[model samples]
Target: MKKLRDGPMDGDMNGNQRTHNFRFLLALAILTPLVVSMTVMGLATFHFGRLSVGELTGTIVQQTVARVGAQLKQLQDVAQDQNRLNLKVMADRPPRAGDFKRVAAALAPSFEVNDELDGVYYGVEATGEFFALLRGTNQVVNLLERTLDPDGQWSRRISRWSGTDWQFLEQLPADRYDPRTRPFYQAAKTARATIWTSTYEFWPHRPGDRRTTGVTCATPVYDGAGQLQGVWGVDLGTIELCDYLAAIDPEVPGYPFIVGEEGDGTRRVIAHPNRNMVIDARTGMLFRDANGIRDETVKAFLRQIPGRFAAHAVHTASHTVPLRLSEFAPDSVAARTRTFEFADHGTNYLGGCFVTGRDDRLLIGMVLDKKEVMRHVNRNAAWFAATFAAVLVASLIGVFGFARRASRPLVELQREAHAVGRLELAPSDPPLSHIREIRELGNAMALMKTNLRSFRKYVPADLVGDLVRSGQEAMLGGERINATIYFSDIAGFTPVAEQLRPEEIVEHLGAYLQAMSDGIAQHSGTVDKYIGDAVMAFWNAPRPNPAHAADACRAALANQRQLDRLNEQWRAAGKPVFRTRIGLHTGPVVVGNIGSEHRMNYTVIGDTVNLASRLENLNKLYGTRILISETTRAEAGSAISARPVDRANIKGKTTVVTVYELLCEAEAETPEQAELRRQTEEAFAFYQRGDYARAAAAYREILQRWPADGVAAALLRRCEELAAKAPPPLSQDG
Candidate 1:
């Protein structure tokens, strides 16, 4: 018994596996039930709470949609009803043709009463006579009337109403101004009833006046004798509608807009909180395409409108059909309110759409971000979670204080291991523990951190960190992926290296490499390797980047900017300036840790890498600073400015590749640089078409404008040589 007690239950062995097992089991047993019960209860509460919140938010959105619909109806109905009233009154007692005074007096009260009315007009179908009263600048009444001039020809006169009299503003030359040819006039005459016209840009009263998009409500009036007399119309532009929608609580509850749909399945934004968003400056018409919209939020909403509305469409036995505005009855409760949900740019949104004007096929829509709706619920949930966590922690602390003390060193070692896994090797002291295994774990983590710190210098820290965090082992294999490869080299680097001392060369080259590496890393690019003065980098590897090409181009431009600053400093010190050239190409390549099992490199390899290297060499022949493959130029899109350089067959590649000289970021380029690029591209096009003479002339023009343009000079010499080798054109005498 004495031998067994001394051998097995000794003090030294107590701190071994038994102590660790006891501490771990004790803590796990005590904390399991407490943590599990609290987590389950919290999840149950959150699930039910979220359901209740969603229902409440849906109701709020429905009400908001109804309110917006009501407001739109009130605005649109005024003009329609006014046109009907004018038709009825005029039909009761037909007015004579060209009775401008009586028509203006009759329409003045209705037009002035409603601030939404942009204008009111009367047209005599029989005599081709017309008169219009419009709310001009500052709400001042303006008139456009057709009258006989002294030359006995019809002329349109523009005048401002001075409350009691009309003061002439400007007179337009006679061009047979006839309202009978207008769309509203013809539609009203054909229907012989009140109807709404499609939106159109109203002609500005003055040359510099802003144009506005408006719709007209037109109705034909007949004489008591049953003879056709004339048509009366009322105009309503989007200005008032935009202002009313803008006045709504746009930031918190929802953003409101009005969309108009035509019978032919065309949709347009008629009114928005941002008035300018709906108005197309180029055509002065309503925005029909969501792509042309400047506001990102509005564009996103418009893009989702079609899909969301189609999804909620009333389904039939045979096919699913979207609910159209024209299908809704004017006064139907269903027409006045409906709610739906959609996601835009990863954010969920709740919205309401209701038919505001069936005749005009307009629907009022309000979009509310889900984040805003759930904000209060989230805040309350956070408070409840915090309170519950605080109580649970307080209870567990007292119950497990002794167990926690026994295991604190192991916990510290676990944290150290996690830190090392993240490649956060900023020198930390190893945790001291009485337990043998715990001390061993801490030492292992310290040594790993030290090794990774040195390993990061050879391999990219990001690549290694990603591999470690994902728990993936570095293996000798790769996968084909679309990536952008970048290569850069200093111009005349060999000669420059020879001129400087070994230490001086190292200092300058070291700073240059560091700056280039930093620029690449800043754009999520991995530095594959450094070949003397040349550095090769790649993007969309280890981490996926959808915009890898653009990122690479931006990094190249940034590196150039960085070199400019360095050169300024070097110039002040009378040191040799190192002009660097960059090349970028985007294509599918094999990227991963590629080497034997014992030694591996996280790099890319393929024809794309070779082409990128070739492009850097071509920059010297073209006298350009940066050249990129056509694939890279296309992937980068309009974010970077580049001009076509030339097409050449890459070594070992059967197909010819087009190249472009990357200038600078599109937004950063000056007008002069843009012009130079434009001329160079134009000349290159001529050269490609075998018009060497014209190409030479274009290059000469470019040189005249930019005297120090080396690219123009080089291309001009090439054009002259090609032109001299060409056979003379056949004489016209033949």
Candidate 2:
């Protein structure tokens, strides 16, 4: 005290005040051990936990592969047994066309013995007679019979088992289907033993019924003199296998697929988690290549597997390893297992491959994305780390209770200040302290936080940030800005809402609104408000976007694309699809905070906005998805592909706006889209020039090409009405 200086010491404004370094040193001393312990603990825990999880994931994949192999082997055994049973019943004699009833009686019990059998059939090689007992998804059993009449005409009849007796289902011409030409029959005849056919599309029971995929295990029935008599076969549908794969660890996110040696001796996908991927849509045949896989993630996983599991080139040179799995049963004749690891796009994956079949022919592959594996490990590790840190903190608090209590108010004040700086102004209780100054500061911060939170709730965060940075208060006012306004409404929303419950409507509309908002926000547009199923948004408001028109158009396109994906998902889930129509216009509008002194909304309003709303409603009449005014099309020139639609007088505006249908991004226009534009424009030209008959003809031609062209249909009807009332056109020569 006696050595107090007249001037500040050590850069302090006052010499009477003690330096704060002592408090800082105390904190450092208390925190040093805790920090070091946590850092070391985290590193060690992650390192060891990663190693353990790696092994665990590998074990899981291997076990899964083994499980699938066992299932496939069991199926093979069942098929062989069924074939043997059928062969013994046939007794080396070919069944006649008239013996179908006897064959059906013999095979009906086979379904009772094994529910997995989709079909059991016998094909006679000499007489070209076939008999099949089949089951369907409806729990109905069908008996199919084919006979080669003496006149060489193939007669086919289908009958279903109606619990008590056989009921005739239908009769169809069987000229296209011959058992001798089928792979299942040809394979067994060539091999002269039991052989499994590649997966193929099963014949549909009736027209418009969904077809199924199945593999046939066929055995050649030989006479005692070594002459071939007939082929006996059992069909195992892959739908059950697909369901089984889906049921395995339903939460795991990883999927399994089976590729097997087919009847053609080439490997192809036999079963997949997605039933659609296992069969070709165009030919109704089993998919033969990975090109049919739609999911990029699944495709990436498939790319790691080789065409043949025996090939050592399953991975790149650095990651390549011999295919071996010693954990598999050592004495199992049909089981051959392999494990491999590789990196794709910086993500490591663990995969296992197992071959199990009559000749080790079927390959089963399982892939686990390492991130999913690590996520589980890291979650557990995080709990451990948090618990360890909490323990250390509790110990320190016990030892230095008084000191911490004294400094707690200041710490809370600092934290609150930082949170306020980040605009996270959630109300928190004021920190208590014995020191009056600390208590006062805490109270002041609490007060500021309360006021700021209320302020934040009332105003846009971006606008608040701008005003705060400029050190200005927001006032009720308006400024004219050239902005692109967007308006969108769900088509047929009333009926859609009527079909849903209250909670369901909330969930459905919430997702739809979120998707639309995301599209607008992604393109630098501001979402102003939602009016039921309608969205009102604008670009170049609080944020200045030079390419506002282009951005607005892009947002509209993006919204439609996202809606398309959402519709597909909804359709598959058996939910109603939301179809939306959007309108865009670029013009000057007043954008600012508007309302009375107590309430305010940051939005845009003007004739431009009204015009956009009108354009959206016009889409109903024109049958269009996106309609943009002439001003918007001009401003967004070369940024979007658009075709001239019509010139219409907006409801509230005096001027007529030439509207255009927004198609796609300029660079994304395809040849077909270009052709559509050309044809539509040609027809529109005729209608525009009062050539009603020619315009009607052109629209009819368009409808012939695009049968579902709603726009063409709408315009064609208008042209037809105009042509009927008009005077007959004079001949060109006259």
The candidate that wins on TM-score is 1
- Per-residue lDDT over 1-734 for candidate 2, one digit per residue giving the tens place of the 0 to 100 score: 23344332454655556554443456567678767877797788778877788677766776676666556556667777887887666644667777777657676766656866778888888877888887755767788888877897888888877665568878976656667878899988998877777677776645665667778889888777898888888888877666656655624546678876644456667777887776667655566665665545556665676455445222212211112232234333123445667776787778767654444456777878888888877788878878877877786676466344446667778788777767777778888887777888888888877787777655556676676556676679999999999999999899999999999999999999989988887888888889999999999979788899999999999999999999999999999999999999999999998998787889999999999998999999988999999999999999988887776878888877888999999999999888888898999888887788998999999999998877788889999999999865555585
Q: What is the C-alpha lDDT of each candidate?
A: 0.78, 0.77
TM-scores of all candidate predictions against the true structure: 0.54, 0.42
Instruction: Give the Cα error of residue 393 in candidate 2, in Å.
Output: 46
**TM-score, model 2 to reference:** 0.42
Error at 407, model 1, angstroms: 0.9
